[model samples]
Target: MRAVETGKKPVLSAEIFVIPIEADRFLVYAPLRRAAFVGNAGAVNFLADLREGRGDSGAGHDGEMIEFLRRLEIVDAGPETPPLAVFSDDPNPVSVTLFLTTACNLRCAYCYAAAGEGAARHMPPELARRGVDFVVGNALARGEDHFEINFHGGGEPTRNWPTLTKTLAHARRLADAHELRLTAYLATNAVLSAKRLDWVVANLHGASVSCDGPPEVHDANRVTPGGKGSSASVIRTLRRFDAEDFPYGIRMTVTADAIPRLADSVEYLCANFRPGQIQAEPAYPIGRGAGAASAETAAFVAAFREAQGRARRHGRELTFSGARVGTLTNHFCAATQDLFALTPDGSVSSCYEVFEESSPRAKIFLYGASAGAGGGWRFDREKLAFLRRQSVDRRAHCAGCFARWSCGGDCYHKALTVHDDGEFAGTDRCDIIRELTRDQILARIADSGGVFWHEPPERIAAEGCACVSCGDEGRIMTGRGVKKPDRGCV
Candidate 1:
């Protein structure tokens, strides 16, 4: 409620985050108002006095600093950022993400789902048909005219080839029959046979393929059933994709072992291949990677920064899920946004990591199930409501964070793991998120003529010449990029 006064003492209004760059210089930020600038310690103390109700009203040096802040809207502006909107009604999602199977062709060391470890479970074609029917029906009823079907990985989606191909054919027929537009994307490890690669190129709209850079780095982790490197197959897939001019993105996972090579990997990918987007994330300990040394460290952040610079040189962006700045949102990804992802058995999961019925966190994420043959779906309203409530605004730990709106509270799935299903506490990813987001902010300022930066359209935030490679179609990025299923998951 504080504001600048004509004769009375001036007051600080917006919440400020002072990030130091030098002994005296700092990045003064007002997140809600979307204002920022670099200032000296004297400028900092001037604001501090105002915050403490002792701001010098005398028209002198402190007065000039006050005027500067006022111009930035940091002296009198109210919080323009609103609370995250929550959906209370029954969920009627237009997008359907199908976790096609749990039968990956390759064994990734940091595989979050630990696919190929289990006996393998393939989604029934009937379940796919039913999901397609439901979504198509919803689209028609809602007058959407278009709907999306995304194939994501609980395992390699392509491993369930018969069902994978057949489902898309069925969806196409439905699209044709109703004269409705249908779009589909897949997430894969990219170790493909010629026929499968050809099928993917021909049938699907796009894909997010997993590739951890050079043969040595990629092969060190991503191997096959008989302990052979899968990099050759992956490279062949990329080559074919390049030849076909296929629309796809490359997802690179940096393990502790891969951290040193991150910049090199990004350099290699940018030099050798042509991918529209390249996203890299530190390997979190989960699945086969559980208890493995975490790549989520300061070293990874330094490496990502270097890799981002390399990617920019190639006219491509290098990104991480949890460090997007310039984005404004409440939830990190689709998990909180009613992402209707179907598990292999036709069960529903909001999170990609919690794919099976037996997953420890199933009760929290598995909110619905197939109501059987003729019946459609049965969702737990309570669970859906709980999920919707997981936005950044409700998170206390994020309340004071300047990057909260941009990072969108990181990843809920990861948060749960870190907090052991208890109250939300910040994670190690917080440091990484803040550092990268800071780099992005500085880059944005530098890009928009560096003295200062306020707000711009999301496209401007996400695109433009910023060195940060953390934008997702102009949407918010957070731990895991907490986004739609079209992006690759490993």
Candidate 2:
């Protein structure tokens, strides 16, 4: 250890890395010593002193050790900002997954859209036109130069070919009219014929097909309404696309039934059909799978994690769509701001899981239907305001969390699902998030030659503001006596 003198104190100096295990737990590794601290005080003090330009002293000071120091300037932890809110005015809505048709060719055991009922109606051409117009107009109004539109379904979007074709044509017209750059995509079961595949290639920017794992795992849950397995057909479709070198992704919905063979599922997909991306979404207990037990859910999570770990080592990227990434550090869920889900009926929502009718937090604005004439669109500004206000309440559990701003309280749906109320705070999910975040930070530090701060690039860039969409722009306009668009009014 190199010894450095700081005002007569001999500070032991060497490069070190630290990852937070949780609010009270952390993994600290230095050339001289490796230990885990149970609280923030020691780490906080050490970080503070280092930020103030104090070099590490060879002598390890309790709660203030200069143990390992580096020549690099520490990354500053900027003020907290809410998640998802950060992109309120993102130049363009990066992606849109439209429920083109609710009709389905198969009946998955865990379908979230409840596809079998007459509720599985094809979006009328007029409604589809309105929906496309709403999204495109909203993007242009916000000054976004580029956008992506994704066509999806409650059952199968391709089932209603005529309607879908019309919608695509309408979307194209809107994009062309505005001269906005756009990418088109589709998420389907691929039960359609080769002709449909050709159409997709010609019109879509990309496609995503559903697969559980292997034939056994996939067939166990994804079966036709007549009880026939659809796995063989799905694989056939994928093989065709793979042979054509079609660009696509795989969407795997992890359920309790599929957990036991999670690794097999991932391996099967990776080995057989190389996809651009793999997304693992946990089953939500609604629609077709509402009766699924919690034990099965837990099993699925374990299996999914195991499979994901292996796949990652093999150079595959697996995204945990439903998992909370920043829970330990902050209380704001990224879905609340980062992305907005526009329902087929023109309801703008925050998270896909929460229905607009059930949760006020989900409603951003309702378009197409008349507002007060029993059918017009209505922008629920009050509901949106309530959600924004509640996001920063700072509960008891959040008082000591160091990554509070970064985590943004995990997923709001997880909170509501696990606790039965959106207003409730804290969960076991936070513990998992803290551990993961700490590990990621430590890993980055080590990769950067050790001795690193815990803050991430996004966290360092964040600046607390009253509105995520407008940020400082709103204040500037207000000072200039210009009327700004009301929050949630878009």
Candidate 3:
């Protein structure tokens, strides 16, 4: 590392990023090392204390921070450390997602797939087998011990049970042939038959069910094509998972209307379903939700805190998007990970939201296709290059942001749709990203015995806070932020 010099002043490491959480309290994080520290008002006097060669306790918490800075090499560090390397262009991806079909039983108000009305599309058995061959070949070439075959779609994967079952079997055969371990994942709306649920529990490693929340909210949005509420069916699916103690989670979509009920939604899900985890995210204004209203920022944050509290009390975890403190990521999701999502017609899309080839976004994101040549699939290297360049380090607007690596310019599809320039800048959710990330940073600090000096033992009730919709139970902020499931959120 080369020292970042400035007129003889001791240089702070460029790798060390800071965010002020409250009066006299700050969170200092090192993305490259995935480490963090907390400091108070006196911490600001680091240079002065160091200049005087004093490590006196009279300097208080600032003096303690000074010691940590020296130990962590964040201060007294002459040179700026380089950021982590960019994602690989020639990737040997170990996971492949088969968009089983673009068909759904429910017509969610904000369905990005606009499911239930799309051209009925299903993945051919040939294409599904080819997708498995492609990913398994790459994993073997890379000498990876294991790989994953995931089911997802612009609509619902369970809708195409025959394709899903056949694909999983084919993938397992490929893994066995290649001497590799294999796992399966499903992203479903969970309104399928009881027999299907039995198959899912027996065959898949884990599943993520797309349910809004309590019946009232879930019924309001996740309805059948015939305009009937499908919440009861989804509830039954959740019950099946609970009965088996299966590893599964609920993915709750928070639309503008759902914002007020955010905490209530959490409580209801936790009380009724008791899922292992609850992954909540605000609705993006894309596809069907493009014409819908958005949740207010402050309200969303407050409700998230409340919901987070409720989730913890029930021994469950609640997650938000674009905010994971422990990860030092270069990309927010799998779009840039060389991962493949095979659409119905044998085309490969980088994002789940851009499955249809006719979509304008597909020009930039649809990176591969299988045309039945040699009875298999193939990737386009040229298109792959474009996806590789979508990392956070390559973005101009994300430059110098403290949460750059943690947030990693989340969701390229959303970025492209909002900015129309394929950059994750100026999005409506930026505030939520920062706030939720800061909460994690502070929590990590507190966990390490550093003070969250400004935080109340219990969350203060913000008058008129939408979190009140869940009840007046005070909350304490921390792990409510979004984290990628072990199987991923897709």
Candidate 4:
């Protein structure tokens, strides 16, 4: 027998062992750890067979051998190493958007807030302040120095100026007292005046305004509750702020009604308001407006690609938040985990849609914490775990997805609403991501003279999937599976 040194044994034992019949070496199995390997050459093959229940137990019996090997620890020789930190250890806390009020003056039909006369209740100033304090204090306790506090609304955020001002002031004070950094942002319709703009500039780091495309598309989608077009007013307000050098981004929600003029809408935005960034979201099926059809989504994506080209032609930089890269990548839905939404009442959600009481995933909320006095602020880890589990478990299809790491699987609410599961299922959303990423890669490859490496495989797959039905088998195969694309291949 080969003299084998023994070390600390594993806590778990194996149920099966394999030994070579011709050689003196044997093999030990540790099914519990999903591992098995060769042992010392001194061990008899017949002894190994007997231990494995394949031979007469008394023939090659070595009771001490079984015990000695059992006491030995197996060393891993695999190349991959475990990560130093797990996903949960990431320092950035999920963002939480707080909508102070649902009472918007403009009546965008697709408004998720359901603002206006019959929407949810508006959060009062005190309640809004409490929510801010709760978030700040909670973050401080977690040793997180910075926190993102976004103010969203059902109607116009400025309409609730009183609450907004107080909340900002309160958040700032709490940030200072707790030695934390706080960033404020707002998503509005851009219908406020100079005074309101000044207040926003002083309090908020940035703002996002809603505009469909040009005046025509904007006017068609955004109207007051009274049915009056809001394009003229919105454009006027946006220009006023733009002239003042207010930092803002243009947000457009593409709908079935807006898809026909997608290219024009993109052109309209580029021409009228040269924004810092352009963000587009397909209309979700909830509240007044339901989900846009697959055809409409495809059309919007095509138009959006054209828009991207137009932006480049004019030397404007356009970025997509959760868009796929090439044929290998998937849509990046940062909001699912990277960003969070906090309601006016201090209830935390993954996003705005999750704030709706009717949403199955909405139950995950940060009410209040025990470390802070006067207010209770807490992040529900259990709920987050549940959500994370659901994301990984239900979306097994996404596990092998090339865009799995980057995309984080589109909107959870969209998955739940459209597919009846909070997990992403195959849909046109994947197509949209693939097309956008393919365009991006093609442009990059052309610019680099077609000699580029380190290009993401997911991006390539996304590009490949865009042209034809790539199917969801996770691997692209050619002719009897004799040749297969990379894991990220289309």
Q: Count the backbone clashes (under 3 Å) in each candidate.
A: 6, 28, 3, 35
RMSD of 2: 8.3
C-alpha TM-scores of all predictions = 0.90, 0.71, 0.84, 0.68
Error of 1 at 185 (Å): 0.4
lDDT tens digits, residues 1-490, model 4?
3222343221223233343434554433332222334455544453345444553332244444544434432122222111111125221342345666667787677766556756555667776666565556557666666665667764566777887788788877877887777777777787777688767766777677777777778877688767878887778767866787777777777777777776677667777776776666666556666453533366777777777777766666554444434222222222323234445544655445544454454554332222344664455566655444433224687654434333445555556666765435666676665556445544554565643213332433433321111111111111111111212111
Off by more than 4 A, model 3: 1-11, 33-42, 45-65, 77-91, 422-424, 452-484, 487-490
Candidate numbers, best lDDT first, in rank order: 1, 3, 2, 4
Which segments of candidate 1 are over 4 A away from where they belong?
1-13, 53-64, 457-490
Candidate 1 lDDT at 36 equals 85
Which candidate has the highest lDDT of all? 1
Task: Tell me the tens digit of each residue's lDDT in model 2 across 29-133.
Answer: 331121223235566566556545563443454423333323221222223233323222221234444555667888888876667656655655665555456
Q: Over the stretch 1-490, how does candidate 3's per-residue lDDT look in tens digits?
A: 2232232333355365567777887676665544566766566466444445453333243344544565665656566433343444454456677788888888888887787784788887878888778767777777777777778867788888888998888887887888888878777888989888899899888787888888889999888888899988898999989898877777888888888898889989988886766778887666677788876377888889888988888888788767665555566666665556778888887777777787668887888777576854567888888876777778888877777776767777778777776435557677787888888877766776764322221221121111101100001000111213442332
Task: Score each candidate by Cα lDDT.
Answer: 0.77, 0.53, 0.68, 0.52
lDDT tens readout by residue for model 1, 25-64: 9998877556788889888887777778776554444555
Q: Which model scores highest in TM-score?
A: 1
Q: Root-mean-square deviation of each candidate, in angstroms?
A: 4.4, 8.3, 8.8, 14.9
TM-score of candidate 1 to 2 decimals: 0.90
